[model samples]
Target: MKKTTLATLSLAMLGATGAAHAQNSVTLYGIVDTGLTFIHNDGGNGNSYSMSSGNMSGNRFGLKGTEDLGGGLKTIFVLENGFNSTNGKLGQGSRMFGRQAYIGLTGDTWGTVTAGRQYDPLVDLVQPVQGDNWLGGIFSTPGDIDNADNSARVNNSIKYTSPVWAGFQFEGMYSLGGVAGATGSGQSYAGAASYSFGQMNLAAGYYHLSNGNTLAARLAGTTTWDSLFNTSVNAAYQSASSINNARIGGNYTFGPVTAGGYYSYAEYTADGRSLFTRAQKYNTGSVYAMWQVSAPLQAEAGYTYMHSTGNSSAKYNQFALAADYLLSKRTDVYAQVAYALASGTEDPAGGQAQAVIGSATGDSGSNKQALVTVGIRHKF
Candidate 1:
């Protein structure tokens, strides 16, 4: 943690020294999210109640700035850090700028390009229309198997995004593998696009990631997947050679109600180092409807179903409900409940049927689990 603090201080000092330009501006911003949560069947054996952090949204602080250069060009940067309000410890492996750290250039006619650690195209363009964006991970995919909870990040990445035209925009990203004599090892890449027409929105994207393994080609240690497979849901696929995901989503607004849904298909392909003999696959579907009952209050209901094939056969059914009240433009309070039922075979290395309502601790020992939480979020 001390190492992260020093890195943060150095970056802040450097930014402060360059804040004298008239056309440059830097702003500090953050979100503090905390809540009380109750779980029926945590780790599949016992019920628990605890104070939690970032159940609705991640707790984070960040510095972002833009400097206008001549000829309609600008320099932009963002340095964001994630933390846990409960323990005052760092998130995302205790990196100083774990959430994001990037510098880039934008132009009037050309597209934008950024380099550093960042979210992939699917998370950037396809997630906004998803239910998780409205009520957080409680409304997300099971085990976040499809990354609907935004748990993955790409390091050593370069991203490009085009300006919106006729309400259409597209993006692409690539993360390099910094191993010597191995250009393609441990690489990750993605592409996505979105279009808006009146009150309707649609998006699609694909992501591919190669596991970091030196025995295959060579050790390309640049790309780090954050160990998303370290959970009970998809643990057996940890030794897979590669992971691929394809997603599509759309949303429509009618009067005071908004409806949306998304579909995702993810495949885990094995290599010689894999645990399973064949490829493992997951198919997930989700939909939600949000109603604006009043000016300051809104409610939502959602449903999700997931199925597994190949290495193991499994099934999961989830239902969720939520309500949000706005205290101010930058503050909100929310309450949500999620219930899940699972049945099927295990992933060998994975645990019994488990759930990830608000935490990734472990799975429910039985075939069912429920989670309830209420929280407050403030942004500045």
Candidate 2:
């Protein structure tokens, strides 16, 4: 009888442990996107074609998990890696989890907090209302100078996100400078908010990053900012002391159609140590519409206008169109085309303002550039 009781108690304890373990969960997910691309007047090459990766979404794999802590609280973590599907090369400077790596805690009443390398608040709150959300970088700003395409990520960052209440949500983030002497050098911070009611959604945000006071840091780029300058649109301002960006966007959906637009203003400020004395500013605006032609077919069209002031008076006009056909729930094929025209004059350091379609294609080396891509994407 004693042995029987002991065995029964042991079984009960084992069952309790198993039940506890059931409350924790982990998931593996990823997206693979690859394509063939053609560029008109690519870097003076004249009609260039090549294999491209990440036409609509970056290739990535991620692990996410959560542990139930009870009382409506939980602990969560995510590790995401970005890569090039065409060459099997690691993306985001070859970091193992370059896309995102964060850990945090959340509760039903209090909200959530996380710390690590992650996207800014603007990307979290504002990007969803923009054209880039559907068509990717091809529909974004010319050089992505304002990070409208999420080309830049913050490191050593802590972020807080509030739970949705009454169709409203908000997020904020701050990155540590990690400079011993100067506390503010190389720092970044952002905040954003969104509201949705019925068929309409709106969002706005502001971001700021300090380039650090050292010339070497500016040349090599700051550790706090992953990729600040990717194209000629803002390459000349890499030596600036700081960058500031503000954006606002909204979208409305009716039946099978949705339309939205966004406006952004970015400025690179010069300090005493920089080459240019005045700030370089960019003003960009874009509008887009999407049609759900069918359950498996969708189409999108957009236009972008960018103007540069402060140090230069360059202008850019772009038109883009895209279509996607779904093969399955997790797979799709897509085609996109974009054309850009450049005008006005650029600073000597920046050379003549050449047309660059988003940040994906190379400069035209002339007044105009065009690009087309046919790609396939799979999610798992």
Candidate 3:
């Protein structure tokens, strides 16, 4: 009888442990944003309109969960995917979790360590108040020059974020290239720091990519007529061996108004000693101010300037204005307009023009491009 009772108790304990182990939860959340965009150019191309997504914020769905582990530690996981709102197609070239996918352990005092495909520190520390994240995407900082849009998500990465101390924190990330023979060949590294004081915030970050040869070659080989016309250069010239980006930015708020600015620099070198083996440097800067006109209405305006120097010396200047009306806490409507001019260079076919980088045509003829977009964004 004693032996039988002992066995029964063991079974009950096993059942209780199993139940406790399963006491965790997961949640699904997402945002969907879309709208119409219109572009006008001086070449009598008139105006073109199209559907777009993530104008205000990227459209995405994510699954996240956390499990409590008795003490002050917890296990967490997140899987997020970006998608197009128009056709419901996967974004980021069909990657399942193109936006983010990671698992980590957290402690109350130490910090968190995560491993997986994840964003670099640049975006985490610098993008929160930038135009791309706060105002709209139309005026993104030169293809998010500082990687503020998380443009440089690292694969096979390990990242650590430190606990905040006196309103200051630090972050670091390293990506394993996953190349068997050349372990460090394709790797990347990034670091950042930030601080907050009252209504003011500041951050600085740096990023470097080692073996971007493949990425550069791919970008160079893909050529289209539009690229030649708008950018004043062939696709080959747009490719770079590796990239180094650095940025510093901050914002200050007083009552119902806020103002901020940032400067970013990118250095691009050719992949090999080809005839186009010349290094190019791109410098960009922007500033803006925003005001809450009323309970539900707000207005923002900004300007940006870019300079490209090297084999081709070109200049680009842009101005933008936008307004937002909050319909509810989770939904808002907005409209934006921007004008850009390109000079000091000619189209690939030797015509002088001003055109947006992605929409350039061979017919230079002093080109000018303007854009207007109206959209609605909803978050959950």
Candidate 4:
């Protein structure tokens, strides 16, 4: 009897220890991707080898943990950082947590609320339909002009996501400026909603920002670039201070083929009336189709058109095509090429202009621009 009692006691202690460990959990995850990219333009022509992070998805290392608090409630946290896979350096201007960092709580009925630098609802709801996300980063539109998926993250944000109902859900976010006495300065806000049913999905979103006077000041201070390009900077800065953007996008899948398009519009108002007083408007439209030719081979193509009006009127049209072959479930080889042309005074200066202001290289916009990229990506 004594021996049996001792064994039972030891077993009970082991069970208690296991329970303690289960209450707290942590996980590590990341991805690594690299490729070669080549660009041809009027300013200069060269073939360069480069490695980039987040080609298909941003390369990142992260730690996530959860502590069960009982009664369907849990405390969770995530700290993620982006890095270049080729050179192993920090991304997003060297910010340590450039990708994401947030802490939050989850409840079964109430949904989740998270704080810190996190993606806005627009990115969550709309980016999936963008070719940029589908084709990787190389051939994406300039600066993801649409901000379709909130390609640009807002700082000091608090976000709330709702539980799904009938395959529909919504989210909202507010980025606190964190600047005292200036309640609206440097702050950004966004909201978005999405619905998914079977193979069809749809989303719409809006974003607004305020108090970007500093950006304008910096542009005015710089004289290295000419007026044409300088004005572009001024226009962009002014728009940031008082800007609005809206988008609607959706995709439908039929067997191995999917087709979709998105429309986006943006308006920027200057801080004070000047040449920049008139609200600058940017409208963009894009459509794309993709098909899986074989079990491991796929092809995709897309086109995007943009028109900027207000301080100046510039027209841009771009076309892109890409192909990919899966080496394995987690690895793929791909190639993509894109061409862009501009009309009006904003045109590339033939081969004489090296970079276009808004173009990838910041050279003159007098000539056509092209980019070809071939790369390999692996996910983990």
Best-matching candidate per TM-score: 2
lDDT of 4 at 267: 71
Ranking by TM-score: 2, 1, 3, 4
- Pitting candidate 2 against candidate 4, the one with the higher TM-score is 2
Candidate 3 weakest lDDT stretch, 10 residues: 1-10
lDDT of 4 by residue, 81-139 (tens): 88988788997558798778899998788888999878878778877766655765433
- Stronger candidate by lDDT (1 vs 2): 2
Q: Which lDDT tens digits does candidate 1 get at residues 334-358?
A: 9988898888875864445555552
**Candidate 1 runs further than 4 Å off:** 1-22, 215-222, 349-351, 358-362
Decoy 4 TM-score against native: 0.82
**Model 2 worst lDDT window (10 residues):** 1-10
List ranges where model 2 is wrong by over 4 Å.
1-22, 348-350
Backbone clashes, candidate 4: 18
Return the top candidate by lDDT.
Answer: 2
Task: Provide the clash count, candidate 2.
Answer: 0
Q: Please list the C-alpha lDDT of all candidates, in the order they appear.
A: 0.81, 0.88, 0.68, 0.65
